[model samples]
Target: MKHRWLLWFCLLLPWTAMASTVQATLDRNDVHLGETVTLNLRISDAMTASTPDLSALDHDFEVLGTSTSSSLSVINGKQSAELIIGVALRPKHQGDLQIPSLTVGGSQTNPLTLHVEAPDTSASTHTGQDVFVEAQASADHVYLGQQILYTVRLFYAGDLDGGSLPNPDVNGAELKQLGNDINYEAVRDGHRYHVVERRYALTPHHAGSLVVPSIEFQGEMLDRGNPNDPGGFFNPGGLFGNTTPVTADSPEVKIDVQAPPASWGQTTWLPARSLTLSLQGLPGDNKLTAGQPLNLRLSVDAQGVSGDALPALSLPTIDGATVYPDQPKTSTHDDGEWLTGHSERGFAIIPQRAGTLTIPEITLTWFDVQSGQKKIASIPSHTLTVLAANGAPAPAATTSPSAVATSPAVASSAATPAIAQVAPAASSPTPWRWIALGSIALWLLSTAVFAWLYSKRKRAQASVTKPRIEPTDSTRTLRQAFLESARGDDRAIQGRRLLAWARAERPGLRNLGQVADALASDEQRAAIVTLQREQYAGVSAETRMDLAATFAKGFAWQQDNQAGTESPLPPLYPFKLD
Candidate 1:
């Protein structure tokens, strides 16, 4: 009998040693109420008959997902296996939450403690309910034609299957969504919830008490109880359970819309939080030649207004130049808080004659909503020196005859003719022949001198004009670098080299967009657009352009037609608001 018992003990020793051990651990011990915590249950040295029972966690945490992984390894000639079950759990409420012990493969895992903090009060607005919504406006009072930012947030705890949140309606105003709906998590009243945030820009056209209607959200909330419903123990309906129809509504907002102030008088009513006027494409040296187009960009950037609300921006009539305006561009963007509007208009200023070209100071008057005062944004007056068409100095109004006579070369040439005439007359006996010879010599000398002066002036003009047609060494080097970089896949280097080459032509060209606009060839413009899209928008490989091939012939610049007469329009308003 003792021998038989020893034999049984020897067989059971291996089984006892191989018994599974379960350990529970959390990836994070502290988290926000709406944030998820990872719970890992590690079972070593055993295989489980079924998944772990996690029904106890239903009270304090919601199971988002679960994953299982198994691995076997050998160390020191001993083989072992481990099974890790990961659970993503979001705390249902704030405070200290306990992860109850779970039974896995007939073994129990240790419990864990997690602390969940509440959500930010400024961003969260919730009641103790399953789903709710709230609305807020940027301001309660605003000027007519000014933009008012409206935000709507929907908070829910269950799975949202489908939903529709309609835009709010306002009397005598325009309301439109600024951007796509934003999905995030937040906690209110200790309960964690999923949040959908939406923004809108509301502009009141007529000044009066405006009432923005409440926005309502209707959706189907899926009841996914116990994501790992083992054997249908927690969810009798199987993997997918019934969905409950839910609805939430935001509160109506009231805004006091005031008209333009009495003091504003007779001018375009421009209401904004802030406004700025900028001018681009001006030469760094403020020097240009007649017949050369000075590309100019006049832009207006305003906060708390739409681009449509702003007046058209135009270049004033320059004294010695003609303005040819391009199609105006206006756009509005939202930065999650304020509605910013930008209006830009490009103009080609061609100097009609060589003189000092003065671009009058431009000013825009706007109502400052923040300060409750009037403000002015202006581009200061600009003075540019204009040269002749061939980059030569402008001719003087009047040339003094005495000045030319006193010239050293002219005086020396005249003296030589006189000396030769006197010498021939004094040496020769035939007075008429000597006189005729001397006259011919004097005439020939005078013609040669005049020809030399003319040629010298022409050479100077040719030198000044040669640079416009001939590329400098630096320009050629940059072009070669750009082409080489374009052949490779390094987009950043290609962009740098391309910009450098383009700047050699148009110094004011800042970005690829401007480069595209400056190009005249359709193919070159298309190539630039494609390159820009590839760099910024992550376009597909098929859309990639062969930059070296497309631009092999070189860039074709846009032609600016010179106007026959100066514009008759008045100068831009230079009103200053103190």
Candidate 2:
């Protein structure tokens, strides 16, 4: 038994050693020249802490830095450990580059291939500068109210300690940052640089020449000189502080803004690169049931514009359906180039009767900057077949022409006898005459009685005044609602209740803003303002002010000094127009 166990152990030892292998993977297989990529070398079941041999990569790539980490894990009652070494590499040239197999802990990893593309030729202008900035505009000339993309790039060869880049100022225009800054690597004149890029959308407000002021960068760069220098460390002479101040300014840009065309009529001037209208959430089958609601979304997307610049979207009145629309939603997205504005509105369409419902086509007109012409974006009309409501009985079946024809003789004979019998009964007018007179007499009596009761009720209604709750009771009820709402976290509900309470005292109050205006006390006004801001601007988790405590004693009314004043001229007609 001992000899057999030894034989089995020898066979298993080779399998265990084979299981300890190394694998290599790349974070990205495709990259542009001068861009960095990460390569991870994973050693499994091997506990050696030594780094992998990366000298083979020096021929086609530049090694930036490296890091190592180790983790131990157990699976199915078996314990194992792994060591991962991450290497950041930049391709020296463009093409397919091979990462040769690397050996670590007596295990060799698999090779990987990476594809690199050449860098942009525009970057060659700033070749040998330690730090420089450049700015460019998407268009040299644009119509008034049209958007122009402005881009600024900052290139530095070394590490930056700190920096501040202010936005460029453009006269007669609105400028806004497009998106977050982008950081990348670029090669200029055979030298690599770290680049920071930012984009802005500038919309010319007035027609004429507009100049965008130069953007400046103020910062400090870290200087790492030779370590062998004697004054590198603890330099009292202030010769080697290892920090150097740097500044770079981008050149100013000029754009010619033209006025709108004279032929363009009195419509909203919308100059954009592209625009589209879409309707979504319709049933795929184009079928609906009566009294069922169909939720729909109408959206408009335009490039080279802001969300606020777009007009509101609405649907026309539908013939057979009632539409309930929600508030419109508008937003803007920046793709490091132009601004894309999106506006969406939701509607619930309830079919009132069973029939064919038609929704009219939606159309929007705008000027296309790219084509220099007017364009229209539209959604085609939609038609839906509306069936009866659920649980409705099916229509009764009809008799076929052949079935009716087969029994025509019997049907005619039976119909003739019934017609003759009915004629004879109709000839007896005496009994029918009495019945008709009785009905006439009864109707006249009912009409007289109805008129008398209606007149009596109208007289009684005129004698008595309409019932109304006193102002104090109404105010108390509103105050209770406001207090109850204040105890909860719903700021909107509190604002509504507070407005109601205020309107009881000041009947003309419409909103919290009006309520604040009518309040006599400054503290109460301030509290109302805070509540309004919290509700309309945004709601926070914690209340900014204690609403219940502030209005505990009720509202203070602003005095009306001209309450009894009479107008010199006759009062205008009292017309309530909604």
Candidate 3:
């Protein structure tokens, strides 16, 4: 009887857990005075399709919006479905507040608590402030038409989700969101912060104290103890998790702006604390021969600054050289109070002309956060020589061709290199036997030297140029690769690859909604969408053939565009190299 009872209890454990769980987690738990926050309710099992009761939250919170997303997944070979319901809330008042419990199916969640603080209105707030949205303008003052930076930050110490947040409205300034929202883990004020940070690159409109208006948001908090029911406390949800909803608000913030200095001409926008400039390849090393390609890399490192605010670095134009900007990446870190990170930019340069060409000084200028002034750092000019295609020098040499042919080995072994005769062959008349023999030897030596130089230049050029293609080109290439993978009947790999490609390609575009936005033409976009859904075996081979043709056409179009002088692609954004 005891053994049978234990078996039954074990069998019923899972059913008991399934019947009692209704989990809830907000996007942020802390908020400021007027910030809106999102509260998500996740139900473990299927429940009646009805909104959970949130009427108890009327005193401290107001609902702004609600959205729901449901997903079903098979984990460890067990099927499970999750229903995620979200609510946008705004705080009604400041100080501690409580959110009432919510019931889903037979399970209930406990109340949630949050703290809301007033915005700092004092002049003493300096560069740091509590519960404020502040913009780090790269320049306090700039000349008209000069570029200035405006980076907005929302800082606070309360539940973030469902907290009343105000929409950022910068009427006095020109603002542009750099890209999609950036979410990362940050450690601030000795506390580990999991923060959702966004970046934007803004150029002022008219220049002055451009005031970015306050943003308001709402969220939920839990009531600690009920004063009316001292003997019997009422928790709507239960003991396990908070079902209550409360609201919070973020403080209003302002920025002081000014005009650019008149002395600085129409220079690049430089909004940073400090910058480090570097030149990767030294051309003076005699590493290339005529008709051979050599690569040069330029990199910049900026710290105590905003990575997105980095300006483009202009390199000196070397004749017979081709240069292109490589796609850039930026890495940022925030230690609670201030954002401190490095932004790096790299360029690939190919030397086509063979001669001693001077690469002039490369300069990077930015606002010096430490000195509160403008500063510039530069890498001085350098010169390089490109030998003749035949592996011979332009200037005449006195040494015979025979001796010149043997010079390469001697230069490799000896401390000093021997100079050979460079006079015209017609001018120097010697015995035919010596001249013929020496000329043949010189010709053979030149072939071998040119071969080595070509190989070396090829390797160097590949290293530098490859980076320019991979980040942007890889995605388009994957579309074809994914089809190839599926052709081989590799559904799993194709599925994963398609998902990854979608993620990369989606955010890269200016807008989202349809796959056509990613492609240059409507026909190509339609083909890609059809191809994306072909994994279920319902798509015909004829359809697949059409997709393949469409991909080929699209690829050819991309290559044509890339080769043309018109740069349809977006301008180079700020990036960092790890």
Candidate 4:
């Protein structure tokens, strides 16, 4: 409590010393020819005040612009008001000049002096050191399939006023831009200044010493340092208390890119910080029933280091079962600094037959940025058990009648027959002594014959009412749809639909590969091949149509396979000829 009162008393002392005080100050003491300097005047504890006269300095300087901003701040529970006025002035010559004192509110500030020098005139210096910018590539050495990082920093210690800066250009490598520019306080070589840094993720096409050439940019420099204060070593030169402009060339960096190892045993080299290959719902012990479909899912993340690196993902060989390869979806992002970031890919796999199954291990290779060596990582192999298809058990053998008669309990039961039961005569014929048995047999045979005859007649009558349709019609209809889709709207979509129709119309084709090949013409096949390439190609309607058509044909073929038989004959109806 005593300290607060003491601070308040000290602050009140300033107001008492100078009533209704006004002060004027300049951000810079010097201005260059064609360059502007700012002069600021602040007024507090007063209202409706006029700005101080700058006409005295106007003779040697031109007023370019002026602005005013007011603010209120509370410190230590006391409110203070501040009104700031700024003037941008351009000097008339490259020589020492004085800015006269000006009054605001009631008090005035002392005069300030600044020195400006002539601009550098060398053409090479102007182009190389003065205005041009270039981005330098780092990590020149890298392994094949490995990633290197290249950072482009804009350096300007000289006159950069009125010039423009563009995003640094990087060519000759796969580049992924690191998020926003980094801004922080940095002291380089004992000189404290605000440094801006930007980075990119780069994957070398093939390992060799790769050059990421420089990028050029131009920007104007504002004289932000204290012009009159010579407190710092890198401050205004001592001779005349004058400040000079600084310009820098874009630093070009060379990286030693290492090549991937020649021997990656049964493993695709995936070098990344973190990677995961999990088959969702995979039997915990990789067990499966015969004819059950298997789904394998793979995910990879490598955000820690620079690389387009990823671990290989694959299905282990399951005995007697067909394995279908899954297409992968991949994506990447930069995690900022020393880390190239990561990407992920997913796949789906189905099992055909049952038995013991083994999924192969997936491997990825990359150059370790920290260790400066190439490394390979992998997703481990998996084993699965598939049970047999048929669920029936074998039957057991029966015991003979003779064996039963030899048993003591059976003989005793037979000898001690029931008192009410009558004994059969020795000469009696077998119990088929009734006429009803023959009559019933004859009746059953006659009924079966009549039913068969009636069924034949019914089928013949039905044939008269309905006619079989030619399978060619369905095939032709699908072909036409495919053709129309090719020329009409959503060609790719329509094409795929048509292919499905064809597959349904004809079941003779076994797999997707056969169906796609059989349904697609040579031109359509080429278009389909190109479509995969164009899936990630730059967006365009024409390209989209082409891709759609390509996929449509393949999928359509699959649909057609489900329709029924491969035979071109008309479908048979349960009816007789008219």
Candidate 5:
């Protein structure tokens, strides 16, 4: 009887685990006054489960928005489904808050607690408090290379005519905007206000205190009457109402960035909330033939980090294989407060001979900001059985290996190496060689006599001329067009001329924005920004851009900086050179 009971229990273990489970979760248990909290009621194995009645939350929190998602997964021949109900909430007031237990599909979730504090309004010299800007960071402390979301929000109950908010500068860190500006409406302190938010992903390379400086906003604000606002109560928003140019600064944030973990001594440092590495290669069976090339696309995607932070992956040079990599493509997308980055590396995998080759596995270990522990994502190693091609010739040189069989255009782009000339093969000495030598000796003697007579007859030249420092044809043409556009009233024409000049110098530059970023001087970047704002801003003309000055600056920069003329990098396939 005991053995039978134990056997029955063992068989039922999988059934028990596969049973449905329901739980309540929150993005954060703590919040700031006026900040929003995201609550989720998640159910596992819940295909028939109905949405939970969140009406109980109305007692403590007001629902801002809600969304639901369902997912399905299969494990060990058992299928499991999940339903997630997301609810965004704003606290009715500040203090301790409780999210009551929710029941769905005969399962009950434990109640959760949230703490809220009031926003600090201090150390500000402003004309009105109704319109202000504040900076916020996800965390104040992080490990080196960890990504943090740093955002600046402009909250305005009044009218905003126009403004300019500069990008933030963080020393020892890289901060780039996640996406374009986000505009939304949120209710805070029982009042509805419009918010303009700009978010950035900050990744620190060095361990230390990364200080994010305050961001300044210069703009005109319309005075909308506020019952609680002492300054804007008397003034009103209208065409001739109080329109004052206000200068506001966001709060400064300091991040305590620590070095990577001890176990992670020295390797590719990738710190993010989530990361994945995937490779898709042709000939899915992992079989290769001599002189046959495989096309591979390797993608590295990470959340909470920018695409630039994810380095391109490559294999070192292999003995019997060759690799040709194209230019890497990178892009970053913003998913609300989170940022997703994707980088692709394309390569042509060509085998030189028939042999079993192993493409080593690649592993990327990253520190999960949420877990505060190291996590790993890897691509498994692949083995290829290469058979000799039908009738391909044997590779000529084993030392240098053979070139890839793909597009000759790629090979032609490679540098043209110098070739040494070979002398004629030696043969037995003959009378014909002697006869040819005698004829050459007579010809030289006649040429020397003619030269002596010509030198006496001609006086070489009347005078020696000085070499002038003349501009190249292209440079002269660019200057003439640039001057004409500078004197003209059309900025669009001038912009085109400037772009043409820049492209002439750096053919790879796609636009003025790229040229501006490549410039090493802040003044030049500012000049480019001003020109862009005017050309696109559609505002009244203000500052003057000196075309000659810009030309001189660009020319000097080109002569000194080689970054703009970077060449294609070689492949990275691992092998020993003996």
Candidate 6:
């Protein structure tokens, strides 16, 4: 009590000249925790300034920063300087707080009251038509780093020019837009309104009362002109086309963001309303054999989160099967106010030998926000049947009189010049018969050897150049290289891989540095430097990039234009004519 009086007395210090009047003000009278409010002291008709005593707010608010400045002006030889002081304060508790009176150079400003409320966790219900907004969450509560759907709905009956909406900037939170805004006609309180709804998947970084402020949108609405004196060529009755300035603001919301539970030990913290994993393009009626490639697609769809937040998934390795995964594709979709995210990845799985192959199940752990418990989403496994090669019977052979008659003629036609040089063994009867039989045997043996070598070569090339897309698409190949490097492929590994890709892409291009200098601008020089450093430098260094997006931004390695790679998963959701 004595300290408060002393601080007020210090602020109320008397001055010899009483030439100034003081006033105290606040940017916001009501605030939540972690929200900083500004307090300003305006002093008019003053010469010099003195700092105000702010010790009264010390018990309730943390003073983040303080500043003071004065404006000086000489108007017709009469000089005046006004001192302005500002302080930033964050609430320390949830209740009413006071900004005590302050005095500076014979000027005393009155104390002001501030209301510090806990985070607002209430669902807003609105039926207004005049450009109003309301916010709601998929779940009222969530754990830290968990997914929570925070949606903002803007309801207006007037014309909207499809005005741009900014992403919400909430404190202590990271948010991703679920998808594009949706506009539709909605009825509320017997009145029709054109609604523009936007949604976001918000993940709170801190465990506390998460207070999200109101979302405000300012835009122009169409309106008829008001005229009593002015008139235009088309304004006989005055109603052509003019726009009025309008604004909409959604109510502030408070969410109870909780900490992870104790039972969820050694699991990822994913708080979501619901989650699902769908595996498309499973082995159908088609028979499987050794070394045969099968395309597989795994898609994960989750509610209350953006697709970007989902963890990367991989198929469990089977000894008999080879797994080749492509880069994952992700997208977010919205159905009205509700949002869903989808991520898909395609894999080329090849069974090494004919046997019963066991593919293991996958499990994803997440917090069930509704139940306030940990939930595990499990994907079922599969046991595939592969046929053996040695068990199949060889094709049967047959010979006839016409076949024998054509044999010598066919051999003579296929014979090379060297073989034709020998005069068909003129000394013996049926001399052409021996020559034909020998030529046929040599041709068959050479063909078998050539076929074996070709097949082996193809398998080796497939493993070395596991193309992200068809080998023909240069941009996709470049993007795949970028994805590989971005996903923590060792620097040395990326260097070799991209070099190999460059050689395959152009066939003639050898020097990557020369290609980079010719094709890319100065902005891309950094990526080139990274490549060189990775190839030559020994110590490990961190490097990151958006491979596909960079390619779109003119980091193109172009050949001739080619079509995009065909999607591995045939349309499982095929359209029906019936």
- Global CA lDDT of candidate 5, please? 0.73
Model 2 stretches astray by more than 4 angstroms: 1-129, 189-191, 223-242, 260-264, 289-292, 387-578
Candidate 4, 419-507: lDDT as tens digits = 11323322342454356568779999999999999999999876555333345766767666666666655535653654465566655
Q: Write the number of the candidate with greater lDDT, choosing between 3 and 5.
A: 5
Worst 10 residues of 2 by lDDT: 393-402
Residue 44 C-alpha lDDT in model 6: 85
Query: On residues 1-578, what C-alpha lDDT tens digit does candidate 6 reach at each position?
Result: 99999988777775424457888877556655545677878888775576767787788888877788888898999877787788877788888888777766666788899997775333235545467777777766777877666877777776765455566778999877765665444455655566666777777889999888876788887755566634577654555557777777766788998788877788667766788877877778545667777788998888766677778877877767889999999997765344567889999988876666777887788777767777788878888777766644223333433454456665544554434344344345376777877998999999999999999999988755545433567656665765666567566666666666666655666776755744435545567666676667743555744433444444454222222235688887789868
- What TM-scores do the predictions have? 0.47, 0.49, 0.36, 0.38, 0.44, 0.38
lDDT of 3 by residue, 220-304 (tens): 4434335554344444433222324543333444445556566657877555555788877675564567566555666666654
Tens digits of per-residue lDDT for model 2, 472-502: 9778999999998988989878878888888
171-236 per-residue lDDT for model 1 (tens digits): 799988876776556666677788777888888889889898887889998876656663375566
Model 4 off-target regions past 4 Å?
A: 1-140, 155-163, 167-171, 189-191, 223-247, 261-278, 285-287, 303-313, 338-355, 360-381, 388-578
Which is better, 3 or 4, measured by TM-score?
Answer: 4
Considering summed lDDT, which 10 consecutive residues are worst modelled in model 3? 554-563
The residue-level lDDT of candidate 1 at 279 comes to: 94
Ranking by lDDT: 2, 1, 5, 6, 3, 4
What does the lDDT read for residue 459 in candidate 6? 90
lDDT of 5 by residue, 247-272 (tens): 77887888899987788877677778
Looking at model 1, residue 379 earns an lDDT score of 88
Better-scoring candidate (lDDT), 3 or 6: 6
RMSD of 5: 31.0
